[model samples]
Target: MAGREATNPGDSAILVAERLTRVLPGEVPVTLVQDASVRIGRGEFVIIRGPSGSGKSSLLYLLGLLDRPTSGRLLLEGEDTGTFDEDRLATTRLAKLGFVFQFHFLLAEFTALDNVQMPMRRLGRLDEAAQRDRAAQLLRDLGLAGHEHKRPSQLSGGQRQRVAIARALANDPVLILADEPTGALDTKSSANVHDILHDLTRERGCSVVAVTHDMAFAQGADRLIELVDGRIVS
Candidate 1:
């Protein structure tokens, strides 16, 4: 998190959220994120920390364009997302961002290579051969070289998670938003996943914003942001 030669987070920002808020409406409205402003620079690894119900996942969802903010605005790579329609938002997410979650979410019927190729196929940037080649390479990079033909059921938990990581990187996304990516892994796998996310910043110059309860994970981040009761706290 520290080796990229520091720059102001707002300088050359890849994603920026200004006073972003998401509120669920009803007779009694509940606010999940309140006036949250965050800036992530290229090659930066940022960690979001808070206890349960502290709005960490809510804030991440907004930043990752999975949920719309009720107020304020969000920008990714300098373009405002506040006005994008659902289709446009989905397209942007497909092209510019990658995601990982606590669950691998692999298709039960697909092989590891096929699962990783799905995103590239959706984006349509690569031809079928290229997609297969890139997916295979990604799996190899993640140490799943021999398992490319195997389905999720055939792999171990760590191996499946690594395959998930490969799928996230399938399109060479500039930013990755991960929600509890290591939550289900053993300690060794957790460390391995952490190092991979960290290396993406140091080695690939890709930014990462992750939600996690692990303080050890936070210790390696360039920025550790904490929220309490839906608001950022000192």
Candidate 2:
């Protein structure tokens, strides 16, 4: 999020972050995150909840590798990410992480299938035929079977979010980081998105760490990470 981005291998943990902190430089430095340590494991659903400006998004960004921490060590799959250069960080993000946001961020003119395949294309791990097949299957699994050819503009809000979820799952990353994935949806749609995200953990053995204000979703998480004033609290 606007604020600013651990995992380890073994015992199903995909990320292990130890005392991560991010500071925004200024005349008076602003600390967006402080001493935030967390572990996200395979097939685990973790929820991050905090008031606005409380560093919830900042912490998520740090965990997701979208932002570098000023200090602290983060290990992803047992590799120390603290030493990764910008190019390596970008490559790592593309290869090992997926993201979802309130806006979906789908290409305006591309079909749902194309959007889902974008990550696979960028990673170039599979040939075109395999990419298409995986993308189509992902959409279908996300309940967009007949709508693969439809563009984001043609789909409903719920459908668009489903497409985004499929796209997030495109690379089959170990962890999926989402910020307000249901922030723009109707009540029913919100519930659907929540359920879909929750199901990913059980069905796909994928870890999910979401920043949300929805208590219903938070309550169902395997763990709820609470943040206040840039610090984790009970």
What CA RMSD would candidate 2 show? 3.6
Model 1 agreement with the true structure over 68-154: per-residue lDDT tens digits: 999887989889999899999999888888999999999989999999999999999999999999999999988898999999999
lDDT over C-alpha atoms for residue 126 of model 1: 95
The residue pairs found clashing in candidate 2 are 5-61, 5-62, 5-63, 6-15, 6-16, 7-14, 7-15, 7-16, 8-15, 8-16
| Candidate 2 local lDDT, 126-229, one digit each (tens) | 99999999999999888888999999999999999999999999988899999988888888999999999989999989999999987876768887888888
lDDT of 2 at 183: 88
State the lDDT at 210 in candidate 2: 97
Per-residue error (Å), model 1, residue 5: 21
Please name the candidate that would achieve the greatest TM-score relative to the true structure: 1
TM-score each candidate.
0.95, 0.94
Off by over 4 Å in 1: 1-7
